[model samples]
Each structure stands twice: as C-alpha cells, then as structure tokens.
Target chain A: MANMYNDKVMDHFMNPHNVGELEHADGIGTYGSPVCGDMMQISIQVKDDKITDAKFKTFGCGSAIASSSIATDMIIGMTIDEALELTNKQIIDELGGLPAVKVHCSVLADHAIKSAIYDYAQKTGKHYKGLEGFDPNAEEEDHHDIPEEEE
Target chain B: MRQVYLDYSATTPVKKEVLDAMLPYFSELYGNPSSLYSIAAESKDAIAAARKQVADLIGAGEKEITFTSCGTEADNWAVMGAADALKNKGNHIITTKIEHHALLHTCEFLEKHGYDVTYLDVDKEGRVAPAALEAAITDKTILISIMFINNEVGTIEPVKELAQIAKKHNILFHTDAVQALGNIAIDVKELGIDMMSMSAHKIYGPKGIGALYIRKGVRISNYLHGGAQENKKRAGTENLAGIVGFGKAAELAGNNLQAHIKHTSALRDRLIEKVQAEIDHVYINGSMKHRHPGNANLTFEFIEGEAMLLYLDMNGIAVSTGSACSSASLTPSHVLSAMDIPVERIHGTLRFTVGDMTTEEDIDYVVSTLKNVVNKLREISSVSSKKGW
Candidate 1:
C-alpha cells in the first residue's frame, strides 16, 4: 500500500515537539494505552485563561504519536477557549492529512486537550458551559479487541 | 549498513541449494508428474523424493506426507477435513486459543456450520496444559488441534503429551507445526500425532508450497475437488518447483538441525540478555528454555510496538510486533490476549527471531538499535511520568 501518512505527519512523528512534562502543571489529560492503539497524555500550563504551554507523551502508532505531537504544537500559545474550539479535523488538517483509519487518533488528541482544559476548570472551581456534559473520567469505550476494518 | 533480519519465524530467504534444486523443475525438467513419459517420470520421482525428504524431517513414512499449497492450506485441511470426516462421530473439536489465525478462523468457520469448538486458554507462558485439554474432552470431542510452536510468542506447546491424551481417548490429533519446522525438531511417529502441518517459507524453502503429514489409516475426506493429484485427496496439479525447493530445504534442515539450533539460540540468548540488561521494564515473553532457541519475544513497558518497529526499520533492523496498530485489524494479538497478559502490556509486544545467517555482529547491532529505538519511544511515551522516574 502507499505510505498512508503525508510528509507533515512524518516530520512531526520523527521529531515531535513538547515531549516532556511540566514540574507543576495546571491540568492533565491522559488517553489510550500502549496496549490500546493510542495512549496519549497531554499536560498544559494555563495562565489567566490562556494555554501558555502544551506538552504530550504518546504510546501508539506513527500516526498516533504524530497526532499527539502536532496536537500539542497546535494548542500551545492559544487561549483555553480557543484550544477548546480546535476540532480533530482541524488538527488533522494542520498535519497535512492522516490516513482515514488514523482519524480517531487525532480525535483522541483533540479530546485530550479538551479533557485537560476540563481538568483545569474542575480544579480551579471554574465552569466552562461547553464542558458541563464532559466527564473527565469517561473515555471512548475501550475497543476490546475489535478491528476498525472488518472483513 | 547491511540490514539485519531477525524475523525468521515470519519467513526466511530461500537457501541457494534449495533454489537451485527448484530451478530445474521450473524451466528445464518441467513436466506433468502424472504423464506417461520418461520426462514425466523424472518429475513424479522428484516429487516422491521430496515427500520423503519432508517426511524424514518429522520421522514419518513418505506416504504420510501430502504436499499442499502452503502451511495455511495444510492447517485448513487438517481442521476442516477432520471436523467434516468425524462429524458423524462427534461435532465438538478442541484447540488452544493461541493457535495461528489459520486454525482459529477455521474453527470459527466451523462454529457457523453447527460444529462445537472449545477454544482453550493458555498460561502466562502461552502454553496449553495437557490437563486442560484432557478436561475439555468429552464424548462429543472428535479431534484436538493445537499448534506445536506459537508464531507470535514462540512458545512450544506440549504436542506429544496432548497427542497421547487424544490417543487414550480414541480421538485424532492435529498440530500446526508451521513455525516449528526447521527451527525445532519433530518426530511425529514418536509423538503419536494423527496429523501435522508444515510450511516451506519458514524453513528457507520457497513459499506457495507446504506439506501435511497424515498418519496412515486416518480417515480424512479430500479437501479439494476434481483432479486425481495427491492421491486424489488434495486436488489440483502439483507445485513442482516450489515442492522441489521445499524438499531441498527439508534435507538441509535435517542435516543442519543441531548446528542451526546452537547458532540461532546462542545469538537469541545473547540478544535477550543484553536487551534486558540494557533496558528496563522489559520482560521476555514465552518459555525461555522450552521455546524455540531462535525466538526472543519481549514487551517493553509503556512503548507501542509499532513505534518501536518504525524506529528499528529506520536502523535497517527487521522485527515483528503483536500490536494491532501494525496490522489491518488495529487490535492486539489474540495469542497475547489469550495468555491473559494485561491489554496494556500487549501493545508493546515484539518478536525477534534469529536464523542460521545471524552473526554476533548482527546480534550486537540489533541490540544497540533496539536499545536506541525502545529508549526513544519510551522517552516519548513518558515512562518517567508514569513511574515518577
């Protein structure tokens, strides 16, 4: 098959940005697993309703790791509200384009950022109306050995 | 830099001798083995010799070995043929959960046909206990199919003991020894197995050809219809060139079994020791002693297998992983899951199988490359955050 990823995905995957943790983080969102197809942990440094810094650690396929890395760069320096508005499609689009199967990984990245923002809100006793329905503990149901591509 | 291949269990390059043996059957000596001519006689005789070569590797009678398209075909015939032939006797079949997809999918196929199949679980080491098999057997049990060597984990099953259990209970036994051929020794006669499947590609032979050893007097209905080829049991014209390659490869395997084992296992052992010493949170998978000497299956904690695979590939090192991200399924390996390994750990599973051509330099290079790759992935995986390292 053709190389599923474009040049931009390869670049981010080969040299991911913001790869470490903050000594003191405003919020944390972890998703996926080494066992699961994609496990990503996103840490954000929030300052006065703005995401001053963003970093991620990912355990997944090339596409997944690239998604997490690119997602972190996309959210950095953006306000918390702006980060919340970032969609998975936008994250994928920014990274050129991810394979159709790997679009879920980008979604994981977007969800992780939102989930982190939610963590910050819950801790600081602030409410974001958009995240009212969001459960920080809830995740997209574990696939449990099911294939995305059914024969 | 020369690439180092450590995925021999996946497949091997055809040996020069084997390829040379096959060339004649393809271009020059090519003839219909069944035709009534001297040229045809040569093809028929070569095929007969090939059968014996294959049979000799496993210590079976020449007639017991029936050539097939490939290992999957052999396995399919074994499971489907036994299940169909014994339907009148019983509908229940017993097999381990760690079998290749060939057997697992075939059993699932049988389930749809009103056949009952018991998918037995494996231990943490990925071995199916004979006691487990004995207990699962009942009046409805007609056949027991288990893999001699697991393709992913490299765990060697108790095929002999399991076959004996089947015999005492008057049931036929089948084993997919595709991964076992050439790498491990087998004596089907001594093991008392009713049937066993093998493939050539894994043994430095050509692909598209393999063999199934069916014990004399065992009743199995023909799998393919039409042609009178293969004793009218398996249809279609023979794959002469491929079969010829398989025979020559089998002969080499028989002659070099001990040396091959010692050489591969030494490199495998050293690689495992170095990797464990150099890396942390990495545990070797499968039986360290009972497993194939060439296989080193390991899982690096908190790093995805596919990511590690990509990095190794960049370094010109070939390896395999059980992670679903590397396959179309996008699911973890059924074999690892069947071993009851936590799903999280299963994502990092990797298999590095050495072969005859592997060298100390190659092993060292792979060790260094693996250390570099796994460390990079784990560094990115945030193992420090997970463990407060």
Candidate 2:
C-alpha cells in the first residue's frame, strides 16, 4: 500500500478524522453493496441548516477509507448547499488522486454525503432539489473527469 | 525495516543453488540442443537430466514431460490442446468454479469456440465434491480440469478421487499443480492423474518456465506450432537456462519436500493461531484441516482488503487479498464468492503463504504487526461485526 498510494491517501487511511457515529444525529446515510464488499455510513449533525458536525464509518479499500475521512471532514460546518456542492473529484484531488481502479471509492464517498444530506432533509420534511431523483445505492454516471484518469 | 514476504503462491526468489546450476547454461554451455554438434549434446543431456529431476518430483516418466513457457501455457495446452485432440470423443469439459483464471478463462475461451463446459461448485471448504464431479460427467466429456490446490484459499481439492472418477469414465484428468508442487506430495501414477501443470517460479526456480506432464498414451494436440521441439508437440527454442534452473529447483524441492513442508506449516500455524487469538470477528477462509501446509487466508471483519494490504505493506509485511481494487474491476475474488463466505468477509480477506525461507522471526513480526493493523483499521471502521451484511 505504501508504494501503491500517495502520501495523502496513506495519511488519511492511517489517521482518519471523525471516525465514529454521531448519536441521534440529524441525518444518516449508508451506501455501497454487500456484493462488492464496500459499505459506508455517514452521520451528520445539522444546526441552522448548517452541518455542525459530521462523522463516518467506511468498510472499503484505502481509497474508500480516505475518501470517507476527507469527505466527512470537508463537510463539517458547511451548509446543506455547500455540502451538496462538494464533488468526488475535490476529495480525490485533495488526496493526491487514487489508482484508476479505485476512483469509484471517491464516488461512493460523494454518495454517502448526499445520502446524509437527503436523510437530514427527509427528517425535517423539507426536500432539497440537489437530491431530486438521486438514488443512494444506484451508480451514477455523473463522474467529474480528472485528466489524470485514463479509460 | 525488515522484509517479510508472504506471497509465495505468487512467486518466489530463485534459490542460490538453482541460480548456480543455470549460470553455465546461460553462457558457458550455451548451445542449442537441436544442433547435431557434440557441444550441443551437453544441452540435450542437460535437458534430459532436468526432465528426470522434474519427473522424479511428480513420480512420472521423464519422457512424459513437455517444458512450457510458464504455468499459464502449461494450463493452456492442457485444456485447449486436450479439447482439440479429443474433439471426436467429446466437446464437453468439467472443471470447478474455484480454479485460477488460467483454467477458468481457458475453459471460457473454449466455450466460446463451441465447447460445452460444466463448472462444478465447491463447498464452503473450497473442495469440489466427488458427487459433483460424477454428476457433471457425460458421454461428451473429454477432459476434467481441476486444480490440486486453489491459489487464493489454499484449499486442497480431492484430485485423487476426481482422477479416479475420470479414469472410470475414460476421460482425461488435468490438475493445475502450480501452487501444490513443492508443498504437497504428488505421485501422478498413484493419483491416476492423466496430466498436471507445474511452474518453476513457485518452487524457487526461474520464472518463464514450467512443465506439463502428460501421462503415457494420453494424446493432446500441439499448442505452439513452429519448430519440431518438444517431440513435435510444442515448438520454439527451449528456455535453456530456465529449464536447467527448474530442474535444480525440482531436485532440491524433491529432496527437501518433507523438511520444507514441516518448516512452513509450523510458521503458518503459529501465524494463524496468533492472529485469531489477538483479533475478534476474524474468520479463516476455506478448510483449515484440508489445506496446503504453508497457506492461510483470513478475513478481519468490517475492513476492506486493500486498506489492510497497504497498511501491512507499510509495516514491511507483504500479503495479498481478494480485493479487485488492484485491478480495473471492483469485483472481489471469485474463489471467495464461490465459497459463499459473506461479501464483507470476501472483501476483507487476506492471504498469507509461508515459503521455505520464511522464519519464525518473520512470522512473529508479522503476527505482532498484524494484530495492530487489524485493530487500527477496525478502530476507524464505520462498520463492525455489528453491521449486518
């Protein structure tokens, strides 16, 4: 893994932030499939429509682990609008990029965040246009192409 | 940092003695064996000697061995070639779902070429049931291909029983013994195996060389078609150095087989015992009691394999996993999928194969480091054993 991943990926993988659940959090989202053996959960505390806190649990590869770590950290103190705007590419770019095969992990991380926000909106009985028609478990083709990723 | 490589099933460093035996073949005695010069006789005789050594290891006749480029080629020739030769008798093939991609993909390719294949399923222990073997056999079944030991789970198949069944049905049986060669006892005659595949690199010989043992009177169509090499069966100039190294490795492995197995299995068991004792929600894959002496596969729950593999690599401990994160696909290993081990376990699985050179200190260091790695990953895990799969 040392040679396979960059320093940032290893750093986040080794020492992830906000690693546990937020008890009675305003919103929770879980993504990934048992068939692929990658699962992630995101729990957020919302205050004034702002994410006061966010934590995560990931059951995936280094890319997924780091993706979850950074995704949760990046969303703290962010308003629902700001959190929804965060892209998988931003997480991957911040982590110095993942192997081509592992880029899906970043997507999974993005899915977890949206799912969490969706959960928050549903509990508050308010629907966010950002999550309109978004399926947490379905694979999305909305990948932000990084020049670094080749087919 | 100390290096502890536990991926012997992937390949091994060539031994010093094998290197020494092959050096002369590379330069000093570098004559083409097909040439009719007295100098070239050295190459011919050397090849014969190597064949004898390899034959001695498998307890087969030296004349029955056909040196191949590697285990894949050996496997390719065994399945595709046998299918071609026996096309008149049958167009159906029988194999297990847990085979290496060499067999699985070759069988698949054959299927695309109008061959019918029956993929036998394994039990949780990764053993192909004899009943399944018998049931899959038909009048058009030309060959039954199964691996002696699965590469990923290290589970040993009932090759002897399967071979006997194939014999009873008058079908040829081929076992890919790539992972089983030096670690397990094999007697082709006694096992009633019609053919078997073996690689040099797995037994501390040079890479790019292997041999397929075709039992006497069993016929297979030629794979490579150029020269009249390999008794007009396989063509191309021999991999002279690799063949010599393979012979040396085979002789060394044959002579030291028991000692090698005992040493590796001892370290393997200790590693297993230590990890299980120190960790929770860890499960061993396949049948522990009926596995290769030096192999262990386990899953530390709630963690994906790539993360664990990377962490272990950082700790100077090399292991492999079922994660396809290394490849372009996110699919997990087929072997674990076939075993029906929970998907989480399959994604979290790690494979450790102790080699002849692996020592107690290496295994101990790995055990200690692994205890921490598993715990640390579990600590950061969003899901635990509590997370239902």
Candidate 3:
C-alpha cells in the first residue's frame, strides 16, 4: 500500500511542528469519543486579529495525529476568518489523502478548529461570525422537541 | 515489502494443502450432497469422509457433526434452540460474561423473549471458574454455554469441569470452541459437552463454514427449517468446498498440533519478552501462565490502540486491540473493563496473536517497530500535558 500521508504529514506526526499551548490562550477546543479510542485538544493564541500561535494534542490514529499537526501548521499565521474557512478535504489533501475509512479524523480536525472559535465567541459574547460554518438548521431540528422538565 | 501481521486470532491464511483438497469439490464434485443421483453420491461420500475427519479431530461420532455458515450461527442455534425446545422444562440459561458476542448477544436476545439468563463473571485473568459456574446454576437452568478459550485475552476456561457440573444437573452444555479447536487438543466425550461450535477460518481453512457437535439424545429445535438438510437441523445446500477444506485443516491440525504449539509459543514468548523489557508503563492484560500459546494481550498506557495500530501499519505491521467483531465500536473492550483495568489503559490495549506461519524475523520486526512508536507517543503526550493548555 502507498503511504497515504505526505512527508510533511509524517514529519508532523513523528515530530509535530507545533504542539502544546500558550499559558494564556485566547481560545481552546476539546472533542472526541470515550467509546472510540481517540480524543483531541486544540488551543490557539490570537494577536492583533491574527492567529499568532496554534497547537494541538490528539489521542488518535497516525492519520488523526498527522491531520491535526498539519491543520495547526496551516492556521498559525492566518486571520481567524481565514482559519475558519479551512475544510476537512483540504486537511486530507495536505496529508496526501488519508484512507477512506480514516477520513473522519480529518473531519475531526475541521470540527476542532471551528469548536475553538465557537468557544472564543461565546466567551467574548461578541457578534462573531465563525458560527456560520456550523450547520444552523441542525440546532433548530434538535431544539424543536424540547420538553419542559418535571418539577 | 514485508509486512507483519498480528491479527491471527481473527482468521488465518488457508494452508496450501487445505486449498488443494477443496478445489476438486468446487469443479469436478459439483453435485449437491442432497441429490440422490450417482453423481451426487460422490458428493455425499465426500461430505461423509469430511464428517468423519471433523469427528476424529474432536473425539465425537460422525453423526454428531452438523455444518453451519460460521460460529455465530452455530452459537445462536445452540442457545436459542435449546431454550425453545426446553421451555416447558426451564426458562433460564447460564453463560459467562466474557463470551464472544456470538454467544453473549444471543443470550441477551433470549432475555427479551422472556427467558432469564445468568452471565457469570470471569476473574481478573479472564478465567471463569467451574466453582463460580456451579454457584450460578439453579433448578430452572436448562443450558450452560461457555467458550473453551477466550479470543481476546487467550484465557482458557475450565470447560471440562463446568461441563461435568451441568451434566450432573441434567443441563445441556454448549461451548463456542472456535478459538480452542486446532490450538488445543479436545476430547468432546471426555468433556461431557452436549453441544460445541467450531469455525473453519479460525484454523487454516476457508471462511464461511463451521460445524456444531451435538451429542446424541440431546433434542434441540432447528434455526433454518426450509429443507431436510443437516438431518433437519440446519437447512441450505451444503458448503461442500469449505467443509472439505475445514476437514483437511482439522486433520492437518490433529497431525501437527504439537509442532505448531512449539513454533507459535516460541514466537509469542519472544515478542512478549521484547515488549515488556523495552516498553515502559506497559502491562500484560491476561494470565501470564494460563493462556493460549499463540496470544499476548498487552496495554501500553497513555496512548490509544488506534494510534498504535496506524503507526504499526506505516511500518507494515498488523495487529488488533481485541476481537475484530468489536474493533469498530471504540467502547473500551468490555472484557478489559470487566477485569477492572483503568479506563485510560482500556483504550491502549493491544492483542498480538501468533500462528503457524509466524517467524522469528517477523516477531523481531514487530517488537522493534512497536517499541519505537510507543516511546514517541508517550513522550509527545507528556510534553503536551506539561504545557498546561
């Protein structure tokens, strides 16, 4: 089988370029499953409206580790708006395309980045636009069946 | 490029001799075993010969063997069939907590249908004691089903002693011996089991075929009732090619079990030794002494099994966390959890099983690769945690 990961991806997994977090990060995101054997924690530092530093810690597969490592590298110098636009497909492409079965790991990276921005926006309570990337209709569908709690 | 494969407990490569024995059945002996014509008589004789081979391997009579698609179906038939047939006598069935999902899930299914089931627990080493089993039995217990050997931790159960207890109580005994057959020498008569399941692919035989040994005078209902096949027990045109392959595999195992044990045990022990000596914070999951000669289940803390598997894949080595059936669920292995291993260690468990084809060079490559990957991941995890993000 061909190596699905590029040298950059393997390098990041073997020697991740940017790992760990700033002591006082502007935002952080943590997600994954207890059922599945994977978890991810991402943190970012924003200075002057641009992501000056970004890092991640992933408890997942080789593809998952490589995907998060490359994803953190891609967002380090970009504005929050630019970083928010990054997609799972682009992350997979950066890794030379992961196995189809493992593509979900890339999706996890995309979600982690967006989740951090969501955390930042919620904390600041500012009219942040990062929530646009997340599916809005999903919230409506999920909340429509809310039953009042029993007293 | 050479790749290392450690998932031998899932399935094995069909030996060349077994393949050759099966090829003629697919082409020249294409006639159905059920057909009464002279051409079909050859097929019938072939099946009979294969039946005798299967019986000889396990110390059962030729009449006791009935072929099924795989061990899962056989397990279902044994549990559900016995429950339905003996409903007037009893509504309770007994099995162990560490049974394969083939048996575990079937027992749970029986529960929904008003049949009560008792799932006895195994000790820390994954061994279900005969004393524990005897304690769980009651007047309403109609059947006792336990696996001969665990597929994950390689813990060999006290099947013979448990079977004797069930026999004394007049309860039917069934065992899913898919992992035990060919690896361990078995004598069904001596064990006093009423029913036992075997899968061909577990040994060096073709997939999609297995057998169940039903002792004479034990009545059970049929799962498939379409045709008068398997003596009206299991229906469908026989899987002749696969069964022939299964028989050949069993015969070969019967002839070469001693040599196979020595070869696999040597490789397994060497791998275990290397992993223990090289990897830090690592622990073996099951019994060190009382386990299948071909198995080594280890937990490397801090990192997950999926991560280890991917890194190993990059180095062309293949292993598993547990049984292939539950690999996708990501739920820390229920067996490991039952053993009271910490939650963190549960995700890190790796099951490396050896086979007749494994070589020392292959074992060396796997050990070296695993040591490198585990050290890297642990370092990475510790460094990230200390950053206080």
Candidate 4:
C-alpha cells in the first residue's frame, strides 16, 4: 500500500510490450531467480552491430514486468553499445519511476541487457568496451530479503 | 469497473450498528471512565456492558476480559505477561511455527531474555499436532501459545485437544484467536484455554481496540501499569468509541454466527469451486474440512501471486498474496513456509477471504478475472511452459 505505482508503470504492466521469446535470438540473458521472487529473461536479435528486436519473459511482480517491458522497448533500434549503456536509473526514469523497494527490478533489467550483450560478445568473439569486467553472476546490491516484523 | 472486496481476514468494514453505537461516545459520552461523576458513570456502564457483550461471544465471564490497543497488544500481553509471571517457575514456552508474528515475536523476545522457546512445526495443512506439542513440553515449560486459526491459509488448529494437553501438564495455554473470534464458535471454558487474544477490526468492528481473555485465577503479570484502569492491570484511558463499536459488533456476531458462517462458507466454496473448474494447475492450500469458513488460499502453478493480485486489482477486485514481492519484508508468508509448501508454490499463493458483504456476483467476477490474470501471467512466464501448465 505504501508504494502505489505511477500510471506509466501500471500501463506497461497491464499491456507490456515485447513479451515472449524471440525466435533465432542471437543472445539471451536471464537474471535473478524464482527463489528471490523475481526472474527475467531478455532475448535480443542483432543485425549489423545494432539491436533489431528485443523481447522479454518474466516471472515477477508488476514492477519487474514493467521494467522488463520498458527496457526491451528502449533497447530496440539502438546499437549494441547503446543498448549496453542502458542503466537501471534510465529504466526507472522511462517508467516515470518505480517504488524504492522495487528499484531492484530496474537493476535486474540493466544487468539483463548487459548479460545479453555479454552473451552476444562471447558468441561472435567480438570485444566491446562496455563488456569490460562485467560479471553476470555478480550478486545484486542489497537485495531486500528482509523479513517483515511480526504483527 | 466494479470494486469488490475479498480480504476479510485482513480486516472487515465496521457494521452500521456498530458505528451507530460508537457515535455518541465520541461527543456526548466523552467522560473518562475513571472519573468519579455521573458522566463517568455512564462511561463506566458502557464499558461494563461492552465487556459483557464481548464475554458472551466467547462464553467467558465479564471480569475475565481486558481491553488493549489492538489484537497485537493483547497477544503481547498474553505471552509476555505469562512469561514474566511464571519466570521463577519456568523459562520455557511452546508455540507453533505458524503463529502470527505477534505471538512468535513475543516468544522471540522472551528467548532473547534467556527463556527457552520451542517452535513446534505444523502439519502440511497448517495444523499443529498434539503429540508433537506433548513431546516438546519439558519440566521448565510454563506456557503454550498457539493460534486458533491461521490467517493466511485459514487452517483451524485443534485448540481443544492442544489445550487439554497443556491442562494435563498443568501449563498455561493462550490462543491468538484474532481470525477466529467472529468466524468460529469459541468457548474458552470448554476448550480449557487460560487466555485468548482477539481483535475488533477482524470482526466488523472498529480498529485500535482488542481484548485479552484471562481466565479467573490466571496469575499473569500486568501488561501496563499507571492507573486503576482495566481493573488495575492495564492502565490507559479506555478507547471509549472503539470499545462500544467492538461490543456492538460482538453482540451482532454472536447472534448471527450461524448465518454468517453459512453465508461466507457458501461464497468461499463457490469461488474455490469455480476457479478450480475454470483454471488448470490450481490447488487449494490447507485442509478444507478444518478451515475458516470464509478463507480460500490457492496456489496457481507457474505464475507469481503478486502479478495475479495486481491484474485483479486492475479489474477492481482486491485480494492478498503470500508472495515475497508483495510483502514489506520481501519474505514469503511464514505461515505458508512453516507448512512446508515449496518456495515457488508459496510465491504463487493467493488468499481470498469472503465476508458478510461478499456476494455471489462478486465471486463470479473474481473467478472470471482470475482466469484471465492467471492465463496472461502464465503466458509471459518462463516457468509455466517448462512445467507444461
């Protein structure tokens, strides 16, 4: 009740764009886990060093789904380097803003794009400046697994 | 959009009668109950009458009830009070893992103070086994606190049988009956329960008011001390309006207990049946035979609970979820977790509780909306296809 989503977040959640797996995807990246209660997968189709299409599949809350939806939409038609440059803050800004607690969803989106780019780089044996020292399996910052106080 | 409320276990709307009974207390009858005057006498009489009304609902004596800020406070008083009073005798308390945080946290607090606490595991249906309880009892066990009904899964525990065990051991028994007060018929004497905690908001009464039933001769230490209020045990100026509303609600609940149960159960069963018929891979949580009449907790496989809840909210249907994403703590419901439900399934669980105001049409709308929500979420879910759901 404390974190009512803005209309933009709700819009993407209610009618998310680019939802589902992309056929012949050049790169697919999955982030988070079901155990953490939020998991997302982003599939990208690249052509001539540019992202032609982007899609997502998510098992998570409204904010996570919304973040994935907006992030996918934002990455389309951008060069691989531009797509990799997408940040969680930009995703939050694109969706107007998300709840403070749900900011991790956007962070997951950021890692998801970078992870897909990392996969793409690995597949083509191409090195990109943005891929420097990016660890896909790195733990998220302050993942809120805090248990609620008993009533 | 049609707004429908199906979260009665969380709280109920105050009834008109209860509201009407409380209105005068906020203005004309605002005198302190402790004041020595005619106006104070009116307040005193009102509180006394309310105490009797609440007492009658649970078949307890008027003198046994003490008003508190809320059910959480009552639960705190019961466990903490009993612990302090019996600390010299014993330092051990036994409670189920499925208890609401109020009791669980109180026990935890006692543990921090060097008391040895045993958190008894509940069965798959969220029912505490009497044998496990008996086995856990030790020479230092002074109190046994268990919930009468689980708030999330709606499983009703065997309070009578468990209380008998505690009585046999000569140990005090307290029940967090907040969810059971109006939903079930409770006779403290018949159940041999030494203490019970109840909330007004859960029973179609005003909030910020609850009562702890302490049976005669139960020597629990005072929860609060400042003045002679609450029979010199709890010392606070009474919540005059809230007490009146609770009393009226209790009286009405007692009078309509049978009809309320029949109506809410009918709605709950219809919702569950309809959803199961329309949706695939949906399973009810907890025991249907031994559950709160209005509660229907179901796990929708391969889909998360918060997504379904938000989708339903878009259609003007309000419900609750046990999923970690929806909770402030980011941890799934402790009640469901204690029942050994799989972590994934726990994230997929939704709790729908019908009440006096819920109607057949509302249930139908929920079922139809839920079907779409579940199907939509599953469509975008990565896990659903893997499970062939």
Number of the top-ranking candidate, with DockQ as the measure: 4
Tens digits of per-residue lDDT for model 4, A34-126: 767778889999999999999998888888889899999999999999988888899999999887767753347888888888888899998
Worst 10 residues of 4 chain B by lDDT: B380-389
In candidate 4 the C-alpha lDDT for residue B197 amounts to 97
For candidate 2, give the docking quality class from DockQ. Answer: acceptable
Each prediction's DockQ against the real complex: 0.52, 0.48, 0.18, 0.57
- The digit string of per-residue lDDT tens for model 1 on B113-205 reads 999999999999999889999999999999899999999888999889999999999999999999988888899989998999999999999
Q: Which should have the higher DockQ, number 2 or number 3?
A: 2
Clashing pairs in 2: A1-B310, A57-B382, A58-B382
Q: Compute the lDDT for candidate 4.
A: 0.91
TM-score, candidate number 3: 0.84
Decoy 2 TM-score against native: 0.94
| Candidate-wise lDDT, in order | 0.86, 0.87, 0.81, 0.91
Candidate with top TM-score is 4
Model 3 residue B207 lDDT score: 96
When summed lDDT is taken over every stretch of 10 residues in candidate 2 chain B, the lowest stretch is: B323-332
CAPRI-style docking class of model 4 based on DockQ: medium
Query: Interface RMSD (C-alpha) of each candidate?
Result: 3.4, 4.7, 11.1, 2.8
- TM-score of chain A for the candidates in order shown: 0.88, 0.86, 0.79, 0.90
Summarize candidate 2's per-residue lDDT along A75-127 as a digit string, tens digits.
89888988888898998888888877667544477778899888888889987
Q: Write the per-residue lDDT of candidate 3 for residues B170-252, one digit (tens) a residue.
A: 89999999999989889999989899999999889999999999999999999878998878889999999998999999899
What would the per-residue lDDT of candidate 4 be over residues B86-152, giving only the tens digit for each residue?
Answer: 9999999999888888888888888899999999998899998999999999999999999999999
